[model samples]
Target: MNGMHRLLWAFLVAAGLAGGLAGCASTSSTPSVGVGPDGKVQNPVQLLGQLPLPPGAAIRAEQSLIIGAGDNWVGRVVLDVGRDFDAAYRFFLETYPAQGWTVVSAVRGKNSFMVMTRQERTATFEMVDGGMLAGSVVSMTMAPRNAAVMVPKKP
Candidate 1:
């Protein structure tokens, strides 16, 4: 090929590579479909809402998790509800027992905490007086009662 044709070919090759790289520089956090049809972040912690939370409680979409596997499951769910400290605390106090949990400990006041255990599982929740805006926040964590701190590594 002639020198001019070679120069033009090089320019075209460089432009193609630059365009490909520019396409890679996406500004979106997600590759596609960040929001569902409902306009909320998809793949949310659905486990939170599915748990036996009281009516009107709103689970914090992010500050929740599910851990462990099968019969050894542990999890946490944080909720905000337009309810006073006493009522919310009382709900947990009463709810756990009806579900067959034995109340390990219970306290009542502005910021109260309760611990309940059933079989090999333990559940604990702390009720704060107020949230950043609404009424109160209940943070609850559930785990196996006698979970080992650490286990030996498998071969």
Candidate 2:
């Protein structure tokens, strides 16, 4: 009788452990970003709008740019949206430049956004701190949109 009781107790403990681990694994898995009929990863902004955010969670966009000195030179821009440092960092790395502007480097902290660019000149636009608390920050810097070239005009 004593042996049978011990065996039953051990089995129950094992089953409980397994179930707990499985529950955690499923919860931590990344949410799938389904591909559209066009076979491209769906835009995260649109996706976020559709789903409910985690409790106390908020979303916002941060834009940063660095332009190298010179005409028709390299430029960098980053757009990030997330509270998780790792997720925000990954988002900038995976998204930027591909949209148009070049990307130099991006580093995200629990409450801050950091980036470096070196296309023609280097410039940066980041939140004073990681924008994770409550407020939001957006920044941008670039060459004049209508500046004329310094080259001599042909007769």
* Strongest candidate by TM-score: 1
Measured by lDDT, the strongest candidate is 1
Candidate 1 regions exceeding 4 Å error are 1-50, 68-73, 131-133, 150-155
* Clashing pairs for predicted structure model 1, backbone only: none
lDDT string, candidate 1, 12-119, tens digits: 445446544765695644223243453333433333332466656765646755443223335665777565666677777777688788998887767788888988
Whole-model Cα lDDT of every candidate shown, in order? 0.62, 0.38
Report residue 100 deviation for candidate 1 (angstroms): 0.4
TM-score of each: 0.59, 0.27
Question: Model 2: residues >4 Å from true position, as ranges?
Answer: 1-86, 110-123, 128-132, 144-155
RMSD of each: 19.3, 26.1
Q: What RMSD does model 2 have?
A: 26.1
Kindly list the per-residue Cα lDDT of model 2 for residues 1-155, writing each as its tens digit: 46543443354345446655765777555345454463333443333222222223332222222222223312232332334444534444555444444565554544444443434433343533345663333232333333333443458
Q: Residue-pair clashes per candidate, as listed?
A: 0, 9
What's the lDDT of the predicted structure labeled candidate 2?
A: 0.38
Clashing pairs in 2: 66-123, 67-121, 68-120, 68-121, 69-120, 69-121, 74-119, 111-130, 112-130
